[model samples]
Target: MAFLELHDIHKSYFLGKEEFPVLNGIDLDFELGEFVSILGESGGGKSTLMNIIGGLDRNFDGEVDVNGQPLDHKKEKQLDDYRRGTIGYIYQSYNLITHLNIVDNVLVSLNMTDLSKSARKQRAIELLQKVGLGDQLKKHPNQLSGGQKQRVAIARALASDPEIVIADEPTGALDSKNTAEVLELLEGIAADGKLVITVTHSQNVANHGTRIVQLTDGKIGEDTRLKEAYPTNDHQPEFKPKILSAGASYRNAFQHLSYNFWRNSLIMLGTAIGLFAVLLFSGVGNGVNAFIQDQINSMINPNSITVLKNPTGKNLSTTELQQSLSQYSSNPSKLLLSDHQINTLKKVKNVDKVEAGYQFSAFTVSYNGKNNSGQSLQTWTKAYASDTIKTGHAPKNNEIVIDKSQAIALSSQKKYKSLLGKTVKLSFAWVDKNNNPVQVTGNLKIVGFANGGQAGAITATNYSTMRNLLNNANGATQANFASVNVKNADKVKSVSKDIRNTKENNKYVFGAITVGDILDTVNQYVSIASIVLASIAGISLIVSALMIIVSMYMSVSERTKEIGILRALGERKKDIRRLFTAESILIGLFSAVLALVLAYAGSLALNHVLYGIVKFNMVQITWGNVVFTFVMAIVISFLAALLPARRASRLNPIDALSAD
Candidate 1:
């Protein structure tokens, strides 16, 4: 069987709704250790024929068999394997990877093999030496001379130990001396029992081949064999390097990118910025949420159910409050809950305890004789109080317990010894029903301080005593509402619902007791804020994504020559697409990481600042966010690169190669 055979192969492409034939029923065959050169002028389809033979174009209708294995029309992977395993390719432009060193460029062919790194490196070095580039291991392609670069390309072509070597104008870019040198290298390659096929217009290069074929209008015009085609060797040569290994491929990925990092650093920088934003936004949002949750957990009593009057005036106060008492006061007719409602609410489902309370004032306090105005503490008065006191016990029926600041105001001193247990005469007056001043006197004792405030301490007073005092001083009911605690805090919502179900118009009478509701309110607000902020910042990210798409498209355009070279070197269309997609994914990963970092830092800062005002820890960055953002960014980037990748893969290698 012939080492390589092509029978009646025909190829055509559509241009402007017309079929333009590039190659017409071409037949050719080559044996092992054969050196042949196809000489043709521009537009003669010499490059097109080479492209088809190299498996770059599977569009041609013909039989292309190598060692009796027929080529498949749809099996792009098999064609890739054939190119990778059976063919060594050389290009006139000296197609070398700019991102890798000379040795690494050659070793790329062996990256997917099963060989160890040391072995691959050694093999790469040997190939470089065989191609007369022994001392340029660390040199990038851009740093090498034209002749030197071509030599490196030749070494790379031979790196995988392919059985066939195909050269397209291998000496086209070389001077006379370098051309001869390259031709001699090709002859040597063929002598080593590999078929060497070169397409060139140079007679000197053709004369060096064992056989020469001339082409005109996509058909072979002449085929001639030289008289002395073989040169006898005295000894067998050493073993060449094999294919790439899986392990080597991993290392090569990192090494390959690192080698070309300088050229692509700007892209990475852009990616890092995008990642930082996403991370920062998500981190800060989570942190704020955590902080709010923590604050709610600490401030509200475990068994407490907060009550608020409905602004819509939908339900009367007595109905829900009565049910909350568990006293079976399920009367919608008596919707308004009065003092009698408080007594009934104490018996509701899950009714462990009850404390009726209301806020009186939130103004700055002032002493009769003091230098500065009191810290604006909210004054709370409750009919029943379940607050945990830090220093003193609960007050008696008429006695009042004041915060440390209030005690200091009455005593004109701040020390605990002077403030505590001191019979401080506190006098204040309230307007009566007729708008007359009713002077009141009360003995104030500093029970304790809840938390220090620069202005003043938030103060609490006995609900009954404050009520009596206010009623006497202002001639009105001091305690306007009530508070209730359920047996199980977790069941507060269910019990509250049951309480309301027993009444209709009186739903407004009772307040639903639920810590979960309060927490949900906070979270709802946070979510809204996050959405707004994300939208604002997301506009910028969208712009960046669009920019990324533009950048990838430009990359596809710029790398046409490289893509063509890879195709000629046996890269399938899918492989080309993967390479482009991989590049886009790398870009997205960088962006995601940057976003995460920024989110983390932003969360930390946000938590620190918001903790002061809200008295809560806000935001917790989760691992789920990191992984999600990373995957999302990568998927988006990959998707963005898809169209361009496909465009590149489908490009005609001959056209790409011929482009300036």
Candidate 2:
């Protein structure tokens, strides 16, 4: 029985519904270890018959039988398996992938087999060595001569150890000497128990085969056999099916990318710039939030809530409400908290204690012949007591905690530190019940100095001292603000909220301010600014994605033949897609890594410069941002490669092999 058979094959091409027959009623049978040449003129269907026999052309009415089993050409997967496991093809043009070296080109075919990677590589090297190009295994196709490239093609074809070898005009581009060398190689393959079939127009090429079949106008005109077939080799190597692994695919992608390192690096730089901006802005936002919290916690007691008059039901607009609150705090007026209100605040939940405080916008402090006018004075309270003191201690009953600047103004020789133990005169004016101007004066010892007093001297006196002074001048002694303290810092927010929501006289009671609330508001604004900045940075990412899409499409166009070579090697369409997609992912991964490194370095430099002005790290990168940036890079790259990958996977293997 014949090892292979072609029965009643018919093929045609259609040009606008007009059919041009290429093959008609072709019947052929072949056994192992035979060299057969299909000889014909141009357009006489020699190449078309080779295409059918190689399983590249399936649009024909024919039954191709291997060992009595007919092939279903309509099933693409079956055709793929048949080509992969049964036949090896050698094209006249070589069809070598430009990016792969000689050994790698041969390895491409062996990769479809289940051999270990080391074993596959060993086989590829052996095949290259057998072709007499062992020393040129690392050379690219463009670096080789015509004969050397043809030898590499031969090595690649036989690397898979297929049962049949089909050569289409194998020596069409070679000289007479190189042609004889390739023909002798084909005869040697036939001697090794593999069927060698060559299609050509040359009578000399046909003479090297054991049998010759002549085709005229898509029909066989002659069938002749010169000798009996050789016996099949009993020790042919067997190959199990294997699919390409992701790691191998990525390795190939890295090699291809490295081949054009400068170009790919430029693309990576463009993408990294976008990712760097996003990560930097996110880090800056984090730093700003941390800095604000640190400042607030340092200046105020975290367990204390400041209570002010709730000016809500005053029929004021938003701007008017702000003005009213400012005016009420700055001037001594009806906004002052009465004793009833103070006791009510002290009764609220989580309120450990309530400290009533009075504030005067303008006052005078004098010592000897020196005087500091237009100073602000506040009655000492527990919340304000948390501030750091430069000397002495917090104010006692008849003592004052004056600002460092005020002490300097009242000092004899402008020695502020030395004036801490000196006595100072405090004076202010107020309106009596009859609206009469009354003056009050007193002498208090300066006990301590406070920081941040450039605008005016912020002097703190005991609450009783300020109350007594107001009483002497017939002025109101009501406290304008109250500080409600909670036992635990964690309960400050809840306690503050409850105080602000409390009601009295059918109106909302007091407006509450907690350090946590202020920090939250400031942080919220910082985050919004960061998001806006990052979004602006994201425009560059979109542009980068478009650039990658164009780059991948160009790659598809340039590697069209490589795609064909892989398909002919038994790669599925999904494999082709994965190949292109993997390349894109590698590009993205490289860009992301570059961006992260740049951002971190930039942050370090910025923080170094900023720390001199403000003792804080100005940029803080978190693990979340790092993970998010990498995920963004991968997802965007995958999405960008979709169209190009699909186009590569859907390419016609035959047409692709024929592309320039």
Candidate 3:
């Protein structure tokens, strides 16, 4: 039985409903150790017959049998296996992958074998040596002469040890000397107990082979034998072929990326810039929120809930009541908390201590002929964070603690600290028992200064001082607002809920505002602002993804021949898709690393400049942000590569190989 057989082969090309016959009922038999050359003219069925036997052009009328097993052209996987395990092809153009070195080009075929990695490398080097191009292992196809490239192609064809070596015009592009050398190499391959088939139109090339089959029109016109076939050898290397693994695909993708490193770097840089903007903005947002929280938390007591008399007695939220605090300036008597309300608050659950305090709308402080007017003038309570008092102590009886801004205006900025123990004239209005407004004036010592940051400007005196002055002026002594401190930090919200739910004559009696409520409001606004800015920066990310998509498509166009070569080496379509997809993922991962570096640099530089003014680093990139940036980058690139990869995988190997 023939080692490889073709029975009644027929093939045709279709041009819109019209058929052009290429192969007509051609029967052929090939044995091991035979150097058979298919001699034919241009437009003969020689190449088409080779394609059928090689399992590339499967849409043909033929039965190809290799080693008593029929090749199933209808099953894609089985045909791929046949091409992978049974046949090797060498083309006239050399068809070497430009991105790969000579040895790497050969390894592309060896990668499908079940050999150790080091063994494969050793075999590839040995094969290169066998082709007399050992020194050219590091050289690419473009760097080599036509003969040298054909030698490398020969080494690649034999790398997998396929029983049938098909060379289609192996020396068509070479000179006479190179042609003789190539023919000698083919004869040597036939002597190794394998069938070496060369397709050529040159009669001299056919004479170099042991047998010749002439193809005229679409039929075989002559089959002649010049010499007997070389005897088959029992000692042959065992080969177990496997589908291309994921690691090999990724390795090839990386090599391809590195070969065009400079071009790919531009793509990586574009993607990195977009990621940098998003990551930096996200960092800035994180920093700004942190700064706001620090400033607010340092000024006010976080556990204290400010409770006010609900004059309207309606179901109002904490925000509405807080907003209306200044609106009560015209009718301060309406906001005055009564003894009954204070007692009711003290009895509430989780109420650690309820201190009845006065929060007047406005006050004026005069010292050394300079007067500073401010709002939210309240008597001293635990509501103010004591550690924030930069000078002197909290206000005692007959003493006042004013905002640093107000102190600077009352005295010079240089003398504001010195004015801590100095006397200041304070004046404010309170409603009398009959709800008539009464203005009271007094001399109070400045005991302390409060740095309320850019947001808070306040003035305060002792509750006793304000009450006594109001009493002497026949003013209402009832407290307007009280500070409700909770026992545990966790229960602040629940306790605030209870205070708001407190009833008096079927009406809500008090409005409670926790520090969380204030900070939450600030947090909500800051978060929205940050996300909006980050999202704006994300527009560049979208553009970057589109850029990657374009790059991948261009890569498919550029590497069309490489795709064809890989297909001929028995790579499945899925492997082709993974090649592009894996390369894009590498691009994204590298871009993300670059973006992280850029973001760190941006945050550090920005923080350095801003810290000089605000005394705080306002651009903090968290670990979570770093993780999210990488994930976003990879997802973007992966999604962008999908369609391009599918397009590349769907390309026809025959058409792709012919692409210029």
Candidate 4:
């Protein structure tokens, strides 16, 4: 029995109903330690016969047996394994991948073997050294001469240490001097204890092998022996063949990307711009929400709930009720809160304090012969966040706390603190019990300045001082609103809900408001704006995805020959798919990294500009946003590669190898 056998081989091509036969009844036996040349002219079925033996073309009537077991050519996986473990091929074109260096080109085959990383490099270097191109390992194929390129191809063919080596037209492209050198290299390959087959049209090339089989019209016409076979030195396989790993596939993809970094960087930068816009917009949303919340919290206590009389006897909250109650300043009888309601609110659960407060909208402050007036005057309570007092303490006794702006209007900011000890004439409108408007005036010392946050302030005094002034003026003095306070910040929502649920004769008598209500109102608008802006930015991402799709298809067309080399190397359809997908994903990964860098820079520049104006950072990118960018990048890239990678894998290996 022979080491390799081809029995009753027949092959043909069909153009519709016409039959064109290429091989007819080809019977051959090959063994270790022999170099055989199948000599034929162009279109004489020489290359077709080589393809069948190399497991590249299986559409034939034949039985190929390896060590007594017949091959199942119909099963692609079995044929792939046969090629991977039993056969190595050297093409006339010297098909080294263009992007790889000489050492990397050889490692392409070694990557399929069960060798450690260090061991694979060592063996690849050793193989290149053996071929006498050790000094050119870092050079690309284009840098080498014709004979040197053929030598590299021969090194790749022997990388897997297969039982049989096939060299088709090995010296077809070489001149006389280079041909002699290449022919000598083939003869040395044959000197090793392996079956080396060469296909050629030259009678001189055929004579260099041990035997020659002349093919006439796809049939073997003559068999001649020129010399005896070499001594057998076969041994156990040192490296086992395996499917390519995902890590190796990604590394190959990354290498290809690096090789074409300048071309790919344009796509990466285009993609990064989209991702950066999305990330930066998301960060801005986060910062705006934080800034608004901070401003609100700074102006008023976070736990304070502003309670007012349910003027409309309606179940709604914030329904212009505060505005309506303000209209009763001339008719203070209707707006005044009764003592009974205040006592009832004080009895409510978790209610630490229910301070009855006066808020007469119109107020005038006269200090140092200068007058300032606005609607911000109110009776102070715990609802006023004490920290808002930027210059002095919250008003106590017969004292006034005014907005910093108002104090600055009265004096310079540098000397506004001087007003804390100065006396001011505070005048505001009040009403008698008969609903007659009257002016009330009092002298109060300015004790503190409040830093009216987002919601501005003008002046405030204690409820007792305002009541004393109104009583002395023979005016109505009942509290107009109440500030319900909760010590625990977390229970403010429940307490507010309870306040709104407070009823009189089946009607909710109290309208409640809290920091939550204010935030909800503000955040609803902010959220809508954020989504609109982010969505607008996302259009560019769609364009970027289409760009990647176009780029990937272009890559498939350009790397068609490389695809053939990989397929001929026994890579599966799945591996081919993974290769393109991995490369695309790496592109996305690089784009994401670039986008993150850009987003950080954008946020810094924006925050730097905003902080000077608002005293707050207005753009913030979180870890979640960072993770989202990468995840979306990978997912979109994988989705983009599906069609292109599948098209690449489905390309015919024979046709791809022959593509220009």
For all predicted structures, in order, the TM-scores are 0.77, 0.86, 0.94, 0.90
- Best-fitting candidate, measured by lDDT? 3
User: Which 10 residues in a row give candidate 1 its minimum summed lDDT?
Assistant: 328-337
- Give per-residue CA lDDT, model 4, range 1-660, as digits (tens): 588899999999999999999999999998788899999889999999999989899799989888889988899998778777788888888998989999889899989999999999999999999888989989999999988898899889888888889998989898998888887877787787888999999999898899999998999999888888887874788889998899989998999999889988998998899899989988998899889989888878887988887766777666466566656545567766789999989988998998998887778899989998877788888887768788888788899888888888898868877887899999988888888888899999889888775677648899889889989999988887899999799999899889888888888788888988888888788888888998998899888888889989999999999998998888888889999999999989999999999999999999999999999999989999999989988888889888999999999899989988
Model 4 weakest 10-residue run by lDDT: 322-331
User: What lDDT is reached at residue 235 by model 2?
Assistant: 65
By TM-score, the better pick of 2 and 3 is: 3
Please give the CA lDDT of all the candidate structures.
Answer: 0.67, 0.85, 0.89, 0.88
The list of candidate 3 runs beyond 4 A from truth reads: 234-239, 309-334, 432-436, 501-507
Give me the displacement of residue 306 in model 1, in angstroms. Answer: 3.7
- lDDT by residue (tens digit), candidate 1, 295-320: 44544565666453332234423344
Provide the global lDDT of candidate 1 against the true structure.
Answer: 0.67
Q: Give lDDT tens digits, candidate 3, residues 151-263.
A: 99999999999888999999999999999999999999999999998999999999988999999998989999999999998866766889999999999999999999999
Which ten contiguous residues of candidate 3 have the minimum total lDDT? Answer: 322-331
Q: What ranking emerges by lDDT with the best candidate at the front?
A: 3, 4, 2, 1
Q: All predictions: root-mean-square deviation over Cα?
A: 6.3, 4.1, 2.4, 3.2
Candidate 4 off by > 4 Å:
231-234, 309-338, 360-371, 412-415, 421-443, 468-480, 509-511
Candidate 4 accuracy as TM-score: 0.90
